[model samples]
Structure formats: C-alpha cells, structure tokens
Target: MAELRPDSANRHRTRVKIVECAARLLRAQGAGAVTTRAVAQAAGMQAPTIYRFFEDKEALLDAVAEHVFATYVAGKSLADPSGDPVADLRAGWDTHIGFGLANAALFGLFADPGRGARSAATTAGLDVLRARVHRVAAAGRLRVPERRAVELLHAAGTGTVLTLLSVPPEHRDPGLADAMYDAVMRAVLTDVPTLPADDATAAAVAFRAVAPDLTVLSDAERALLSEWLGRAGTGGDRGQRDA
Candidate 1:
C-alpha cells in the first residue's frame, strides 16, 4: 500500500487531535463547552488551526460526534454474540441504554433531527441493530417483520434513554430501561422458541428470515416467495387484530 505523505499524515493527525479534544469537552462539560477556542486550547493548537480542519463550529461538532459514536460502535461490534439471539438482543438493548446515559451530551447531539438524519455514525449504529434483529428473526423467535422489529427496538431504546436523561440521576427509575425492553420484546417476539403451530404470522416470519438462502430458487422466484410470505405475515397479523 502507498504510504501517506508527511504533510497528509500531519493533517490527519491534527484533525484527529481536534476531534479527540472536542469529544473530551463534550463528555466532561457538555456541548456548550466545546467551543472552537476551548477545543483548540485542549488540543494545544491555535483557534485558527481548527478552521483549516473544520468549516465551522457545527462542522467540528459533527466530526466530534462521529468520532465518539464510531468508537462506541467499534466496541459493540467486537463483542461476541451469545448463542441465544433473544438474549443477545436484550444484552444489546442494555448496552445501548448504558451508552446513551453515559454519553448524555453526545446522545443529545444524535437526538437532534437534522444532525442524526445526516450522520454516518448513526447509520452504522442502526446497521448493527438491524443485524441483531436479523439474528432473532433467523432463530424463529421474531413474530414481526425484521424491519418492524428493528424499528420498534430502536424507537423504544431511544425513548428510554431520552426519558431517563431528562430526569435527574437520583430521580431516574433504575428499572425503566428494563421495562421498556421487556414491552418491546413482547410485541416482537414469539412466546416460545419454536415456531407455533397455530401462529401463521410467526411461521411466515420465520420462513421469510431464511428465504434468501433458498438457493434452489431463482432470484425472481425468491423475490416472489418473499413477497408472498410478507403478505401472509401481514394478513395473519390483521386477522389476529380483527379477532
């Protein structure tokens, strides 16, 4: 591989230093304390130097958020999944709540609709969530469509963290996160590990999970099968609602 030129290497290092310093300020003192001057002082560089790496304060904050969130995601990705997918999903939910509470300022930054909608790190984190939900579906434990399961978990986790953060630490309910996770799991999961003989929706969901691996079918055939399964799952869900 080609080596980075000295100037390019120095620029990269300088950018990383700026992001690290900003992240420290964010974690310790919140977003209000991460001004350009403060970050420059923390990084031992002139304030003007920050402009060379970042366009403005918002740009710098965006970088800092990405840096901090990416580090968290990297750690999560490295963890070995437990053999039980449902248990693993719960573990992931707990990890998410802990991360959000620990990184209040960073989590708030992500909660901003504009910032989160455009954040690459946020997208990466969601991808990890999607993978976990996919595993549960593959294990035939999921009753809802994989996408819906992921959305429900994601929404519930975010809401739980934000609610907890909104209250003083001493006032926060320790069991709130657990309660939210349990409620979401009940909505998305089958009561039993094995597919229920009477639950057509659960069967369709389980079959849908493995449909992509049905190699004997052509791509078009697989796509058609998936469409049918999706409708079947929806219909079963509707029937239950009507009952």
Candidate 2:
C-alpha cells in the first residue's frame, strides 16, 4: 500500500498538469487547439497518457470548463445579503457580466447548449443565481415567480455576453447590458403604487405567483399545485367582476 502511494501521487500530479496545459491551450487558441497531441506535448507526456485520465477530448474539455469556471467563481468577492435585494441582485449581475467578458474563451465552453446542460460548474452558478433571485422573493418584491425570474436573468445575461462577444471590442455597445437589465426589470418588477391591492382576487393572485417556486413539493406535486392555483386565482378574479 505504501508503494502505491507514490504512483497515485504521480498520476494525480500528471492529471492536474494535463488539465492545466489543456486549459492554457484552450484559452490561448479556443477549443480547436486543445487536441490530445497538443496537450500531451504541452504537459510533457505521451498522447496515450492523456487518455489515462480523460476518456476523450469532450471529457477533457468538460474537466477544463469545470476547473476554470469553479476557479473564477471562487475568486469573485461575492457580496453578502444586504438591506436592498434588488441592489444585491444588480451587483451579482454586474459580476457575472464582468466574468464572462474577461473569460470569453472559457465562457464559450459552458455557454454551448450541448455542454452547458451537463456542466456541474454551470449548475453551481445557476444555484447561486437562484439564491439571489430568491432573496428578491423573500423581500416580497419579485413580481414574477422566482423560477421565471431566474430563467429570465439567465437568458438575458447569457445573451448579453454572447452578443457583446460577437461584436468587435470597439464596436460593442457599452450600455447594452444595462439596457437589457432595465428591460427585464420593467417586465418583472411592480411599481409600489400599482402593486396588487389587498383583496381576495389580489391575494389569490399573489399566492398563485409563488406557488411554482415552492420547493416543499416534488415536480409533479408542484405542477399540480400550480394548476390548482391558476384556477383559484382566475375564479377569484371572475367572482370579483360579478360582484
């Protein structure tokens, strides 16, 4: 067992070295440059040894993405929950955009739909976003449901990054992201004066709005509750109209 220790240590070191090399190549020249031959050469290992760690190029890229995104996320000076949830959310949004713009090459890897869905690091990032959205919900300010807000923010943020990256740096619109965020806010937030009034119809609608965001139920159960809530909210509105 003692003799096995040295071999295990060597393999771990080699794996890290290979991943680091692949990541560098990927960053320097995009995904096309991370071939096994290139990585092995960069890491001072035979091409066959590369397969000892990663099953294939996709697997290796996935590891590279996981490592890179995780490192970037860890490095962020994430803010603590504060007095204003919307301000907190905006801070997070700015940080997300900064990271994507700074790491365009690596950001593209996880942005691809085929790979993004399978990435543990991307999922972790979504969880963080969800928590931020949840803070808005907990503050009683999220006009849209929590899940819908998350989906909207994810789409808007990802789209903003990709759109900016598509343009040359000099031609890119500096205010586009802020404008998009404003559009999303306009659609998702309620003005204080026009918030739903305190009444049966309004109360039902409020309850229904959050029904889908509840986590106490399974997916099927949540779906059923959302359906029921929809009916209840509609019926309340109809009754109010009749009266």
Candidate 3:
C-alpha cells in the first residue's frame, strides 16, 4: 500500500478531529448548542482554525451528518441475505433502531427538516436503503410492489425509532418499543399479499377472455361494479347504489 504523505495525513487528521468534535457536541447536547467556539474548544484548536476546514456551521453540520451516515452504513453488513423477508426486515429494523437509540440527539439533528444543507447526506442514506430493497426484492425475499414495500418498510422503521426516542427516558418501556416494532413488521411485511394490486389487476385482464364472467372491468367499470356490489350485498337497489 502507498504511504500517505505527512502533510496530507495531518490535514485528514485535523478534518476528522473537527468532525468528531462536532458530532460529540451535537450528540451530547443538541444542534442548537453546537457553536464554532464550543467545537474548537472540544477539538483543542483555535476557533479560526475551524474556518480553514469548514466554511460555516451549516457546512460543518453537513459533514457531521455525512460522517454519521457513512459510519452507519459501514457497520451494518449482515451476511444472511437468503433469509426470509420478515427476518431480513426485522434485522434491518433492529439495526435502525439501535443506531437511533445510540445516537439520539445526533440522529435528530441529522434528520431535522431545518437542516437543509444536510439533504445530500439524507439522500445518500436513502439511496443505500433503496439498494437494500432492490437486493431483497431481486432475491424474491421481498413481496411484490417492490417500490411501495421498500418505502413502507423505511417509513415503519423510522417511525418506530422516532417514537422510541420521543418518549421520556423515565417513562420509556423497551417492551413497548419492541411491541410497536413487531406490529409494524407484521403489518408491513408479513401479511402483505404476494401479488400487488397492479399485478393482480393485470392478471385479471389477461384471464378476462377466458372467463368473462370473472368481471375484468376497467377502472370506471370497477368503480361502478364496486358500488353496485355494495348495494346488492346490502339488499339495496340501484338508487341506493347511486346515492
């Protein structure tokens, strides 16, 4: 391996120091408490030296977010890709929740909607999630409706973690958190039908000619038929259906 030059290595070390300091302060306190002076003091450097590495506080926060995301992705490499989708989903959920629990304040700041400069880091994390979804889907681990399933999984995981973090520490119950996570996993992954609505509809159309009595109607006909069925099932007439 080629050796890193002294000046280049020093610069890299300094940059890491600044980012580490920022991450520490933001995590211990909050983003609002992270100031240039505080970070410089934490890093044991002159305040002006920070400007040499980052242009402003926003830039520093963005760098910290990117660092946090990179560290998260680097640490989460499970070898069991051939597992059941529910198991894979549950594992992913645990990893996400563990990160949030470990880095509550840091994650809050990184995910804050006000942190516009950190959008790139957020997007990068989402890209990693999207790739994971594709991998699981290609392996037939994920159910159909790949994009929707992936999005719902992401939403459910994030929502559970956030809910856990929002509870006061004194009142929080880890059992409840586990319950919520399991509930979301069941609703999002386990019980979902293998044939998505779109695919099912396409299948219906493909078999329509063979079984016209099966009613492979277009959207308008489907809506009308649904209303009619509702009325007929309830012993109501066309007037009630129209109503």
Candidate 4:
C-alpha cells in the first residue's frame, strides 16, 4: 500500500478530531448541541476549518453518529459466536437493547427514517443480524425464511427500544424487552434444531441457508435453488398466517 502523504495524514487526523469532539457533544448535549461552531471550538479549530472537513452541520452530525455507532458495531462484531446459534441471537438482541439505551441521542438520530436510510453503519449492523439469522437457519432452528426472521427481529428490537425510551426511566418496564424478544422468537424459530420431516417450509429454509456453500452446484444452479427455496419458505409463512 502507498504511504499517506504528510498533508493527507494531518487532514485525516483533523477530521477524526472533529468527529470525536462532535460525538462527545452529541452524547452529552444531544443533536442540538452539535453545531459546527461548537464542534470547532471543542476541537480547537476555527469554525471555517470545520467546513473544510464537513459540508455542513448536518454532515457533521451524520459523521458523529456514524463514528460512535461504528465503534459499537466493531465491538459487537468481535464477540465469539456461542456454539448454540439461538443463544448467540439472544445475546445479540440483548447487546442491541443495551446499546440503544446507553446511547439515547445517537439511537434517536438513527430512528429518523431519512438518516437511517442513508447510514452506512446502520447497514453494517443489519448485515450482522443477517449473518446471525443465517446461522440459525443453517441449524434448522428457524421456522421462518431467513429474511423474514431478520426483519422481525430488527423491527421488534427497534420498536421495543423506542417504546422503552418514550417512557420515563423510573416507570419503564424492566421485562418489556425480554417479552418482545420471546414473542419474536416464537414467531420465527422452531422448538428443536431437528426440523420435522413434514415441515417442508423449514426444510427448504435450512437447505437455502447452505445452498451457497454447495460446491457441486454451479452459480446459476445455486441461485435457482435459493429462489425456489425462498418461495417455499415465504409461501408457507403466508399460509400459516392466513390459517
């Protein structure tokens, strides 16, 4: 790799400093506190200097949210997966709840649909969730299609956190998060790792989980297999719901 030029290295460090300072302001004083002037003063730079690194206050705030959330995601991704995929999934849920509660301001920033849609860190977090769901499906524990399980878990987790955050801490139900998790798990998971022979949907889901890794299949074959399996899994889900 080519070495960074001196000017480029200094610019990078300056940008990092601005982001860190803005993040501190955001955590302590919320989004309203993270103005360009405030961040510039906090970082020991002129206000104009901030413009060199960020287009505007909105851009600076986005960077701050991404910086803090990326750190949390990095730590979360480093955890060793438990041998039991279900346990790992539960652990991930717990961690997500904890992170949201701890970083109320940052979490609220992400709660905004417009900002969240454009967030790279948010996408990375979902990628982690997708991987965990894949593991559960591969183990034959997922009753729903992997995509459905991931969406249910994500939606439930987000709603639970938002609900808890809306209430006063003193009045918040300590068990609410756990209850939501249990409900979502019931909707998505099988009781046992070994799926029933009659459960064609779950069998298709499990097969779909491992389809990409089947070396004997060509790329086109695996893609076609996955498409068929997805239809089977989702069709069963719809039928069950209708029943």
Candidate with best lDDT = 4
Between candidates 3 and 4, the lDDT winner: 4
TM-score attained by model 3: 0.67
Which stretches of candidate 3 lie above 4 Å from their native place? Answer: 1-5, 78-82, 114-121, 135-144, 190-243
Cα lDDT of model 4 overall? 0.89
Instruction: Give a tens-digit lDDT track for model 1, residues 149-202.
Output: 888888998999999999999999999998998899889999875555768787
C-alpha local distance difference test of each model: 0.88, 0.77, 0.64, 0.89
Candidate ranking under lDDT, highest first, comes to 4, 1, 2, 3
Better of 1 and 2 by TM-score: 1
- TM-score for candidate 1, please give it: 0.94
Estimate, for each residue in 1-243, the C-alpha lDDT of model 4 and write its tens digit.
998899999999999999999999998988899998898899998999999988998899889889999988888788889899999999999999999988889999999999999988999999999999999999988888887888899999999999999999999999999999999999988888755575777887888899999999999999888877887877745543311
Model 2: per-residue Cα lDDT over 1-243, one tens digit each: 456488899988899899999999988898999999999999988999999999999999999999989876655435467888788889888988988887788889888998988877788788888877766655556565556678899999999999999999999999999999999988665544124463333333456556667889899998777666545445534332211
Model 1 has an lDDT value of: 0.88
- Model 1 Cα RMSD, 1 decimal: 3.0
- TM-score, cand. 4 vs. native: 0.93
Scored against the true structure, residue 67 in model 2 reaches a CA lDDT of: 90
The TM-score values for the models, in the order shown, are 0.94, 0.77, 0.67, 0.93
Question: What lDDT score goes with residue 96 in model 4?
Answer: 98
TM-score-best of 1 and 3: 1
Cα lDDT for residue 218, candidate 1: 100
Q: Which pairs clash in model 4?
A: none
